[model samples]
Target: MRTAKFWMGTLLAGALALGYGCGSDANKDPTPQDVPQQQVPDAGADAGVVLTLTDAQIARVLQVANEGEVMLGQYAAPLATDQAVIDFNNQMVTEHTAVKQRLDALLAAEGITPEDSPLSLQLQAEVQQLMDVLQGPNAPAAGAALDLALLSAQLNAHARTAFIGDSLLTPQATNTALQQELASERQAVQTHINEASDLQSVIVLPPVEP
Candidate 1:
Protein backbone atom coordinates (compact mmCIF):
# COMPACT_ATOMS: atom_id res chain seq x y z
CA MET A 1 0.00 0.00 0.00
CA ARG A 2 2.94 2.33 0.40
CA THR A 3 3.46 2.26 -3.34
CA ALA A 4 -0.18 3.16 -3.76
CA LYS A 5 0.31 6.17 -1.50
CA PHE A 6 3.37 7.24 -3.43
CA TRP A 7 1.54 6.90 -6.75
CA MET A 8 -1.33 9.11 -5.61
CA GLY A 9 1.03 11.68 -4.17
CA THR A 10 3.05 11.78 -7.36
CA LEU A 11 -0.07 12.32 -9.44
CA LEU A 12 -1.26 15.08 -7.12
CA ALA A 13 2.09 16.83 -7.30
CA GLY A 14 2.10 16.66 -11.06
CA ALA A 15 -1.42 18.07 -11.28
CA LEU A 16 -0.50 20.95 -8.99
CA ALA A 17 2.62 21.72 -10.99
CA LEU A 18 0.57 21.81 -14.18
CA GLY A 19 -1.95 24.20 -12.63
CA TYR A 20 0.59 26.49 -10.97
CA GLY A 21 2.10 28.53 -13.80
CA CYS A 22 1.02 26.99 -17.09
CA GLY A 23 -2.20 28.70 -18.09
CA SER A 24 -1.56 32.39 -18.49
CA ASP A 25 -0.79 32.52 -22.19
CA ALA A 26 -2.56 29.52 -23.62
CA ASN A 27 -4.90 29.95 -26.54
CA LYS A 28 -8.51 29.48 -25.54
CA ASP A 29 -9.58 28.31 -28.95
CA PRO A 30 -6.76 26.34 -30.45
CA THR A 31 -6.86 26.26 -34.22
CA PRO A 32 -7.05 22.81 -35.78
CA GLN A 33 -4.09 21.59 -37.78
CA ASP A 34 -3.88 19.12 -40.65
CA VAL A 35 -1.82 16.06 -39.82
CA PRO A 36 -0.38 13.98 -42.64
CA GLN A 37 -2.43 11.02 -43.74
CA GLN A 38 -1.11 8.27 -41.52
CA GLN A 39 -2.22 4.85 -40.36
CA VAL A 40 -3.25 4.54 -36.76
CA PRO A 41 -3.56 1.18 -34.98
CA ASP A 42 -6.41 -0.88 -36.45
CA ALA A 43 -6.28 1.41 -39.50
CA GLY A 44 -6.43 -1.49 -41.91
CA ALA A 45 -9.88 -2.44 -40.66
CA ASP A 46 -11.13 1.02 -41.43
CA ALA A 47 -9.47 0.97 -44.83
CA GLY A 48 -9.73 4.48 -46.29
CA VAL A 49 -10.50 6.35 -43.05
CA VAL A 50 -7.40 8.44 -42.67
CA LEU A 51 -6.46 9.37 -39.12
CA THR A 52 -5.92 13.06 -39.78
CA LEU A 53 -7.74 14.01 -36.61
CA THR A 54 -8.83 17.48 -35.56
CA ASP A 55 -8.37 18.91 -32.07
CA ALA A 56 -11.93 17.94 -31.32
CA GLN A 57 -11.28 14.38 -32.40
CA ILE A 58 -8.20 14.18 -30.22
CA ALA A 59 -10.21 15.44 -27.28
CA ARG A 60 -12.79 12.77 -27.91
CA VAL A 61 -10.14 10.07 -27.97
CA LEU A 62 -8.57 11.44 -24.79
CA GLN A 63 -11.97 11.36 -23.13
CA VAL A 64 -12.31 7.74 -24.13
CA ALA A 65 -8.98 6.89 -22.52
CA ASN A 66 -9.83 8.71 -19.34
CA GLU A 67 -13.24 7.16 -19.08
CA GLY A 68 -11.84 3.71 -19.72
CA GLU A 69 -9.37 4.05 -16.88
CA VAL A 70 -12.10 5.13 -14.54
CA MET A 71 -14.22 2.16 -15.51
CA LEU A 72 -11.36 -0.29 -15.10
CA GLY A 73 -10.48 1.12 -11.72
CA GLN A 74 -14.05 0.88 -10.51
CA TYR A 75 -14.43 -2.66 -11.75
CA ALA A 76 -11.19 -3.79 -10.14
CA ALA A 77 -11.92 -2.34 -6.73
CA PRO A 78 -14.22 -5.09 -5.51
CA LEU A 79 -12.15 -7.84 -7.10
CA ALA A 80 -8.67 -6.83 -5.93
CA THR A 81 -7.34 -8.36 -2.69
CA ASP A 82 -3.87 -6.93 -2.39
CA GLN A 83 -3.72 -3.70 -0.43
CA ALA A 84 -1.38 -2.07 -2.95
CA VAL A 85 -3.56 -3.09 -5.87
CA ILE A 86 -6.67 -1.87 -4.10
CA ASP A 87 -5.01 1.44 -3.39
CA PHE A 88 -3.95 1.75 -7.01
CA ASN A 89 -7.46 1.10 -8.20
CA ASN A 90 -8.91 3.71 -5.86
CA GLN A 91 -6.37 6.32 -6.90
CA MET A 92 -6.97 5.62 -10.55
CA VAL A 93 -10.67 6.11 -10.04
CA THR A 94 -10.09 9.38 -8.24
CA GLU A 95 -7.54 10.81 -10.66
CA HIS A 96 -9.26 9.75 -13.84
CA THR A 97 -12.62 11.10 -12.66
CA ALA A 98 -11.01 14.41 -11.79
CA VAL A 99 -9.12 14.52 -15.07
CA LYS A 100 -12.27 13.85 -17.04
CA GLN A 101 -14.04 16.65 -15.19
CA ARG A 102 -11.25 19.06 -16.03
CA LEU A 103 -11.33 18.02 -19.66
CA ASP A 104 -15.06 18.49 -19.81
CA ALA A 105 -14.71 21.96 -18.33
CA LEU A 106 -12.04 22.87 -20.85
CA LEU A 107 -14.17 21.73 -23.73
CA ALA A 108 -17.16 23.63 -22.38
CA ALA A 109 -15.16 26.82 -21.91
CA GLU A 110 -13.97 26.60 -25.49
CA GLY A 111 -17.48 25.76 -26.71
CA ILE A 112 -16.06 22.62 -28.21
CA THR A 113 -17.87 19.34 -28.39
CA PRO A 114 -15.44 16.55 -29.02
CA GLU A 115 -15.96 14.80 -32.34
CA ASP A 116 -15.46 11.05 -32.64
CA SER A 117 -13.07 9.46 -35.13
CA PRO A 118 -12.08 6.01 -36.24
CA LEU A 119 -9.25 6.10 -33.71
CA SER A 120 -11.59 6.84 -30.84
CA LEU A 121 -13.93 4.04 -31.87
CA GLN A 122 -11.10 1.56 -32.04
CA LEU A 123 -9.90 2.57 -28.59
CA GLN A 124 -13.40 2.08 -27.24
CA ALA A 125 -13.44 -1.43 -28.60
CA GLU A 126 -10.08 -2.22 -27.00
CA VAL A 127 -11.26 -0.90 -23.64
CA GLN A 128 -14.40 -2.99 -23.87
CA GLN A 129 -12.33 -6.08 -24.48
CA LEU A 130 -10.40 -5.42 -21.29
CA MET A 131 -13.60 -4.95 -19.37
CA ASP A 132 -14.97 -8.18 -20.73
CA VAL A 133 -11.89 -10.04 -19.64
CA LEU A 134 -12.37 -8.80 -16.12
CA GLN A 135 -16.13 -9.07 -15.89
CA GLY A 136 -16.93 -12.14 -17.95
CA PRO A 137 -17.85 -15.56 -16.55
CA ASN A 138 -14.26 -16.76 -16.73
CA ALA A 139 -12.79 -13.71 -15.01
CA PRO A 140 -9.88 -14.38 -12.70
CA ALA A 141 -10.70 -14.84 -9.03
CA ALA A 142 -10.00 -12.02 -6.55
CA GLY A 143 -6.40 -12.69 -5.58
CA ALA A 144 -2.97 -12.80 -7.19
CA ALA A 145 -4.42 -13.85 -10.49
CA LEU A 146 -6.77 -10.86 -10.53
CA ASP A 147 -4.07 -8.52 -9.32
CA LEU A 148 -1.64 -9.65 -11.99
CA ALA A 149 -4.29 -9.36 -14.66
CA LEU A 150 -5.24 -5.83 -13.62
CA LEU A 151 -1.63 -4.67 -13.43
CA SER A 152 -0.82 -6.17 -16.81
CA ALA A 153 -3.84 -4.53 -18.39
CA GLN A 154 -2.90 -1.15 -16.95
CA LEU A 155 0.68 -1.53 -18.12
CA ASN A 156 -0.40 -2.12 -21.69
CA ALA A 157 -3.11 0.55 -21.64
CA HIS A 158 -0.94 3.31 -20.22
CA ALA A 159 1.95 2.50 -22.52
CA ARG A 160 -0.30 2.80 -25.53
CA THR A 161 -1.80 6.02 -24.16
CA ALA A 162 1.62 7.57 -23.57
CA PHE A 163 2.66 6.61 -27.06
CA ILE A 164 -0.42 8.18 -28.57
CA GLY A 165 0.07 11.34 -26.55
CA ASP A 166 3.67 11.70 -27.60
CA SER A 167 3.42 10.57 -31.22
CA LEU A 168 0.02 11.89 -32.21
CA LEU A 169 -1.85 14.23 -29.87
CA THR A 170 0.96 16.59 -28.88
CA PRO A 171 2.19 16.99 -32.45
CA GLN A 172 -1.30 17.61 -33.79
CA ALA A 173 -2.18 20.13 -31.09
CA THR A 174 -2.51 23.64 -32.49
CA ASN A 175 -3.82 25.17 -29.28
CA THR A 176 -1.21 25.93 -26.67
CA ALA A 177 -3.66 25.03 -23.94
CA LEU A 178 -4.43 21.63 -25.40
CA GLN A 179 -0.74 21.01 -26.01
CA GLN A 180 0.08 21.87 -22.42
CA GLU A 181 -2.74 19.68 -21.17
CA LEU A 182 -1.59 16.79 -23.31
CA ALA A 183 1.95 17.17 -22.00
CA SER A 184 0.69 16.94 -18.46
CA GLU A 185 -1.41 13.91 -19.39
CA ARG A 186 1.60 12.22 -20.94
CA GLN A 187 3.56 12.74 -17.73
CA ALA A 188 0.74 11.30 -15.65
CA VAL A 189 0.47 8.28 -17.89
CA GLN A 190 4.19 7.66 -17.53
CA THR A 191 3.80 7.84 -13.78
CA HIS A 192 1.04 5.24 -13.98
CA ILE A 193 3.30 2.97 -16.00
CA ASN A 194 6.02 3.23 -13.39
CA GLU A 195 3.66 2.49 -10.54
CA ALA A 196 2.04 -0.39 -12.36
CA SER A 197 5.45 -1.87 -13.09
CA ASP A 198 6.43 -1.58 -9.44
CA LEU A 199 3.24 -3.28 -8.31
CA GLN A 200 3.73 -6.04 -10.83
CA SER A 201 7.17 -6.76 -9.38
CA VAL A 202 5.71 -7.57 -5.97
CA ILE A 203 2.85 -9.75 -7.18
CA VAL A 204 3.36 -13.50 -7.60
CA LEU A 205 0.84 -15.29 -9.72
CA PRO A 206 0.01 -18.94 -9.42
CA PRO A 207 1.38 -21.34 -11.99
CA VAL A 208 -1.07 -22.37 -14.65
CA GLU A 209 -2.49 -25.87 -14.39
CA PRO A 210 -1.93 -27.64 -17.68
Candidate 2:
Protein backbone atom coordinates (compact mmCIF):
# COMPACT_ATOMS: atom_id res chain seq x y z
CA MET A 1 0.00 0.00 0.00
CA ARG A 2 2.85 2.39 0.74
CA THR A 3 4.45 1.64 -2.58
CA ALA A 4 1.17 2.14 -4.35
CA LYS A 5 0.66 5.44 -2.56
CA PHE A 6 4.11 6.63 -3.49
CA TRP A 7 3.58 5.82 -7.17
CA MET A 8 0.17 7.44 -7.10
CA GLY A 9 1.60 10.56 -5.52
CA THR A 10 4.26 10.78 -8.19
CA LEU A 11 1.74 10.28 -10.98
CA LEU A 12 -0.56 12.95 -9.62
CA ALA A 13 2.36 15.31 -9.15
CA GLY A 14 3.30 14.85 -12.78
CA ALA A 15 -0.23 15.39 -14.04
CA LEU A 16 -0.39 18.51 -11.95
CA ALA A 17 2.84 19.83 -13.30
CA LEU A 18 1.61 19.32 -16.84
CA GLY A 19 -1.73 20.97 -16.16
CA TYR A 20 -0.66 23.79 -13.86
CA GLY A 21 1.23 26.95 -14.94
CA CYS A 22 -1.11 27.52 -17.87
CA GLY A 23 -2.24 31.13 -17.72
CA SER A 24 -5.88 31.63 -16.95
CA ASP A 25 -6.23 33.74 -20.06
CA ALA A 26 -4.61 31.25 -22.40
CA ASN A 27 -7.94 30.65 -24.06
CA LYS A 28 -8.38 34.31 -24.85
CA ASP A 29 -8.51 35.57 -28.40
CA PRO A 30 -5.25 35.58 -30.29
CA THR A 31 -4.14 38.71 -32.10
CA PRO A 32 -4.04 38.26 -35.82
CA GLN A 33 -0.58 37.89 -37.30
CA ASP A 34 0.59 38.07 -40.92
CA VAL A 35 2.32 34.68 -40.74
CA PRO A 36 2.63 32.89 -44.08
CA GLN A 37 0.68 29.69 -44.43
CA GLN A 38 2.80 26.63 -45.16
CA GLN A 39 0.79 24.14 -47.09
CA VAL A 40 0.40 20.80 -45.32
CA PRO A 41 2.15 18.38 -47.63
CA ASP A 42 0.64 15.16 -48.86
CA ALA A 43 0.78 12.51 -46.13
CA GLY A 44 2.32 9.86 -48.39
CA ALA A 45 5.00 11.99 -49.99
CA ASP A 46 7.55 14.19 -48.21
CA ALA A 47 5.67 13.91 -44.90
CA GLY A 48 7.07 10.93 -42.99
CA VAL A 49 3.96 10.01 -40.98
CA VAL A 50 0.80 12.08 -40.97
CA LEU A 51 -2.13 11.73 -38.66
CA THR A 52 -5.28 13.81 -38.99
CA LEU A 53 -5.92 15.51 -35.64
CA THR A 54 -8.87 17.68 -34.78
CA ASP A 55 -8.29 21.28 -33.86
CA ALA A 56 -9.26 20.48 -30.26
CA GLN A 57 -6.61 17.79 -29.94
CA ILE A 58 -4.01 20.16 -31.29
CA ALA A 59 -5.06 22.78 -28.75
CA ARG A 60 -4.84 20.22 -25.93
CA VAL A 61 -1.33 19.37 -27.02
CA LEU A 62 -0.44 23.01 -26.88
CA GLN A 63 -1.97 23.39 -23.45
CA VAL A 64 -0.12 20.40 -22.03
CA ALA A 65 3.19 21.46 -23.49
CA ASN A 66 2.78 25.04 -22.32
CA GLU A 67 1.63 24.19 -18.81
CA GLY A 68 4.18 21.44 -18.40
CA GLU A 69 6.95 23.97 -18.90
CA VAL A 70 5.53 26.30 -16.29
CA MET A 71 5.34 23.50 -13.75
CA LEU A 72 8.86 22.20 -14.32
CA GLY A 73 10.32 25.68 -14.71
CA GLN A 74 9.20 26.64 -11.20
CA TYR A 75 11.18 23.78 -9.67
CA ALA A 76 14.72 25.10 -10.05
CA ALA A 77 14.27 27.82 -7.45
CA PRO A 78 12.79 25.59 -4.77
CA LEU A 79 15.24 22.73 -5.39
CA ALA A 80 18.28 24.94 -5.92
CA THR A 81 20.24 23.38 -3.04
CA ASP A 82 20.98 20.32 -5.13
CA GLN A 83 23.11 21.27 -8.12
CA ALA A 84 22.34 18.10 -10.01
CA VAL A 85 18.61 18.46 -9.60
CA ILE A 86 18.81 22.15 -10.38
CA ASP A 87 20.71 21.47 -13.57
CA PHE A 88 18.22 18.85 -14.65
CA ASN A 89 15.29 21.08 -13.74
CA ASN A 90 16.75 24.00 -15.64
CA GLN A 91 17.29 21.89 -18.74
CA MET A 92 13.71 20.68 -18.63
CA VAL A 93 12.46 24.24 -18.29
CA THR A 94 14.48 25.41 -21.27
CA GLU A 95 13.46 22.50 -23.48
CA HIS A 96 9.80 22.63 -22.50
CA THR A 97 9.71 26.42 -22.95
CA ALA A 98 11.05 26.07 -26.47
CA VAL A 99 8.50 23.39 -27.26
CA LYS A 100 5.73 25.59 -25.87
CA GLN A 101 6.83 28.45 -28.10
CA ARG A 102 6.86 26.15 -31.10
CA LEU A 103 3.40 24.90 -30.25
CA ASP A 104 2.16 28.47 -29.92
CA ALA A 105 3.59 29.36 -33.31
CA LEU A 106 2.02 26.30 -34.84
CA LEU A 107 -1.35 27.22 -33.39
CA ALA A 108 -1.05 30.72 -34.76
CA ALA A 109 -0.19 29.38 -38.17
CA GLU A 110 -3.15 27.03 -38.11
CA GLY A 111 -5.40 29.83 -36.77
CA ILE A 112 -6.52 27.45 -34.04
CA THR A 113 -6.77 29.06 -30.63
CA PRO A 114 -5.99 26.85 -27.60
CA GLU A 115 -8.62 25.87 -25.08
CA ASP A 116 -8.48 23.83 -21.87
CA SER A 117 -9.66 20.27 -22.25
CA PRO A 118 -11.50 18.16 -19.69
CA LEU A 119 -8.31 16.19 -19.31
CA SER A 120 -6.40 19.34 -18.53
CA LEU A 121 -8.82 20.21 -15.75
CA GLN A 122 -8.54 16.75 -14.30
CA LEU A 123 -4.76 17.00 -14.35
CA GLN A 124 -4.87 20.38 -12.68
CA ALA A 125 -6.97 18.98 -9.85
CA GLU A 126 -4.59 16.13 -9.31
CA VAL A 127 -1.63 18.51 -9.22
CA GLN A 128 -3.38 20.76 -6.75
CA GLN A 129 -3.96 17.84 -4.45
CA LEU A 130 -0.31 16.90 -4.64
CA MET A 131 0.71 20.45 -3.87
CA ASP A 132 -1.50 20.42 -0.82
CA VAL A 133 0.26 17.35 0.44
CA LEU A 134 3.69 18.79 -0.22
CA GLN A 135 2.80 21.94 1.67
CA GLY A 136 1.32 20.03 4.58
CA PRO A 137 3.10 19.58 7.93
CA ASN A 138 3.73 15.90 7.28
CA ALA A 139 5.57 16.74 4.06
CA PRO A 140 9.05 15.32 3.58
CA ALA A 141 12.02 17.32 4.85
CA ALA A 142 14.15 19.43 2.48
CA GLY A 143 16.75 16.86 1.44
CA ALA A 144 16.43 13.43 -0.06
CA ALA A 145 12.74 13.25 0.67
CA LEU A 146 11.98 16.51 -1.07
CA ASP A 147 14.32 15.73 -3.91
CA LEU A 148 12.79 12.34 -4.36
CA ALA A 149 9.30 13.83 -4.38
CA LEU A 150 10.18 16.41 -6.99
CA LEU A 151 12.24 14.02 -9.09
CA SER A 152 9.67 11.28 -8.92
CA ALA A 153 6.89 13.66 -9.90
CA GLN A 154 8.90 15.08 -12.77
CA LEU A 155 9.88 11.62 -13.95
CA ASN A 156 6.28 10.49 -14.14
CA ALA A 157 5.28 13.76 -15.72
CA HIS A 158 7.92 13.50 -18.43
CA ALA A 159 6.95 9.93 -19.14
CA ARG A 160 3.30 10.85 -19.47
CA THR A 161 4.08 13.89 -21.60
CA ALA A 162 6.33 11.81 -23.83
CA PHE A 163 3.61 9.25 -24.30
CA ILE A 164 1.20 11.96 -25.35
CA GLY A 165 3.72 13.49 -27.70
CA ASP A 166 4.58 10.15 -29.27
CA SER A 167 1.29 8.31 -29.30
CA LEU A 168 -1.39 10.98 -29.35
CA LEU A 169 -0.04 14.30 -30.69
CA THR A 170 2.65 13.21 -33.13
CA PRO A 171 0.60 10.55 -34.83
CA GLN A 172 -2.48 12.75 -35.25
CA ALA A 173 -0.88 16.09 -36.06
CA THR A 174 -1.04 16.89 -39.78
CA ASN A 175 1.07 20.04 -39.77
CA THR A 176 4.67 19.42 -40.72
CA ALA A 177 5.96 22.02 -38.32
CA LEU A 178 3.92 20.62 -35.45
CA GLN A 179 5.09 17.11 -36.25
CA GLN A 180 8.72 18.15 -36.23
CA GLU A 181 8.29 19.95 -32.96
CA LEU A 182 6.58 16.94 -31.43
CA ALA A 183 9.36 14.65 -32.54
CA SER A 184 11.98 16.84 -30.95
CA GLU A 185 9.94 17.35 -27.79
CA ARG A 186 9.34 13.63 -27.53
CA GLN A 187 13.09 12.98 -27.67
CA ALA A 188 13.75 15.61 -25.04
CA VAL A 189 11.09 14.21 -22.73
CA GLN A 190 12.60 10.77 -23.04
CA THR A 191 15.97 12.17 -22.13
CA HIS A 192 14.50 13.81 -19.04
CA ILE A 193 12.83 10.55 -18.06
CA ASN A 194 16.13 8.72 -18.21
CA GLU A 195 17.94 11.41 -16.28
CA ALA A 196 15.26 11.57 -13.60
CA SER A 197 15.34 7.80 -13.21
CA ASP A 198 19.12 7.88 -12.88
CA LEU A 199 18.91 10.60 -10.26
CA GLN A 200 16.18 8.78 -8.35
CA SER A 201 18.31 5.66 -8.20
CA VAL A 202 21.07 7.47 -6.31
CA ILE A 203 18.83 9.26 -3.79
CA VAL A 204 18.91 7.47 -0.42
CA LEU A 205 15.67 8.14 1.39
CA PRO A 206 15.49 8.15 5.18
CA PRO A 207 14.16 5.00 6.76
CA VAL A 208 10.48 5.19 7.61
CA GLU A 209 9.45 4.87 11.27
CA PRO A 210 7.08 2.10 12.29
| Model number with the top TM-score | 1
Q: What is the clash count for each candidate, in the order shown?
A: 0, 1
lDDT of 2 by residue, 1-210 (tens): 011111223333343344223212221121111011112212333234323345555566556755755675475347645667777777777777777777787778877766555445444554454455555565555765666566655654665566456545666677676667677766776666667666655554323679
State which candidate has the highest lDDT: 1
Give the range where candidate 2 is weakest over 10 consecutive residues by summed lDDT. 29-38
Model 1: number of backbone collisions: 0
* Off by more than 4 A, model 1: 1-50, 205-210
| Error of model 2, residue 161, in angstroms | 1.1
Model 1 superposed RMSD (Cα): 15.1
Q: Estimate each model's TM-score.
A: 0.73, 0.63
lDDT of each: 0.65, 0.53
Off by over 4 Å in 2: 1-53, 205-210
